[model samples]
Target: MAVPGWLDDTRTSYDTVAVSYADLLRDALAAEPFQRGILALFAELVRAQGPGVVADVGCGPGRITGYLDGLGLDVLGVDLSPGMIGVARRDHPGLRFEVGSMTRLDLADDSLTGLLAWFSLIHVPDDEVPGVLAEFRRVLRPGGVVLLGFHAGDGSRLKTEGYGGHPMHVHVHRRRPERVAAWLEAAGFTVEAELTHRPAPDVEGGFVFAHR
Candidate 1:
């Protein structure tokens, strides 16, 4: 399938700022206790089923991927930006990082034990989210889990600049947690838990844990 225009734009934008983005978020997990807790829970759930691979989709710089690795999960990172993948590989030499898209994963059906879409779906257009979620569903083994983190809101915002004022060309789309749950259900996932929290005073974070 040809890459969607928006996906191409997002890939280009991230590639342009991959270095800066990596530097800025390299140590972010250190301060995020809630996110870490969620990740621990996710790791436990995936490990309960048996030994299998986990794909960290849109794993910029591989921080979460590396973290999951430390938790003893066989995890690989994938992103649309080759530059980001390069940084991820460089930063975590032991783990695998590759250039790939969430919209159409290259893996075989029922291959993954778990998938993490950690705040990465924000760049995807609202209309395309279902297809992406379906792709996530397609790649997972039965009883596999997926964890999604995204901004909670009712609309989209065009991010013009980020990471030390570098120009960006992506629209960050926020969705209600209920709406996202509906999408996951449509994609054949059973919603396990939904969390909405304020990581910062101004930012609302949404997390959904679901099973296939």
Candidate 2:
């Protein structure tokens, strides 16, 4: 099948800003106490299921990937942007990073014990989310954990610039937690947890912890 236009634009935009993006968010997780707590909790959940590997889907520059690794889950970082993967490998030479997409992840079924898509689904359109969630389910082992983070609310916007004011052409989407939970259920995932956080007056964060 032919690739979608938005995928190309998103890939190009991230490739254009990969280094600056990496630099901007390198130390970001340290300040995010809630994100850290949940990640640590997630690592525990996966470990409790016995030994297995985890994939950080849409891993960006591998910040969360490294954090999860520190928490003791064997980690693999995958992203839609090669530039992002390059920076990931450069910054964390000890870990594995690959160029891949959640729309169609390049992995075998039931291959992962855990999966993370941190704020990466914000770029995907609403119509595409179910397919992406299905892909998530396909790669995860039965009872495996999946973590998803994204902007919370309704509607979408065209992100024209970001990360040190570099030009970007990607759509940023926001969805309510309930809606996402419904999608997860429809995809044969059991929704385990739902969290919403507000970083600013107008910004709401959505996180869903689910199991396949």
Any runs in candidate 2 off by more than 4 Å, and if so which? 1-4
Evaluate residue 148 in candidate 2 and report its C-alpha lDDT on the 0 to 100 scale. Answer: 91
Q: Which stretches of candidate 1 lie over 4 Å from their true place?
A: 1-4
How does candidate 2 fare on TM-score? 0.97
Q: How far out, in Å, is residue 59 in model 1?
A: 0.5
Report, for every candidate in turn, its global Cα lDDT versus the true structure.
0.92, 0.91
In terms of lDDT, the poorest run of 10 residues in model 2 is 1-10
Over the full model, what C-alpha lDDT does candidate 1 score relative to the true structure? 0.92
TM-score per candidate, chains pooled: 0.97, 0.97
> Which pairs, if any, clash in model 2?
none
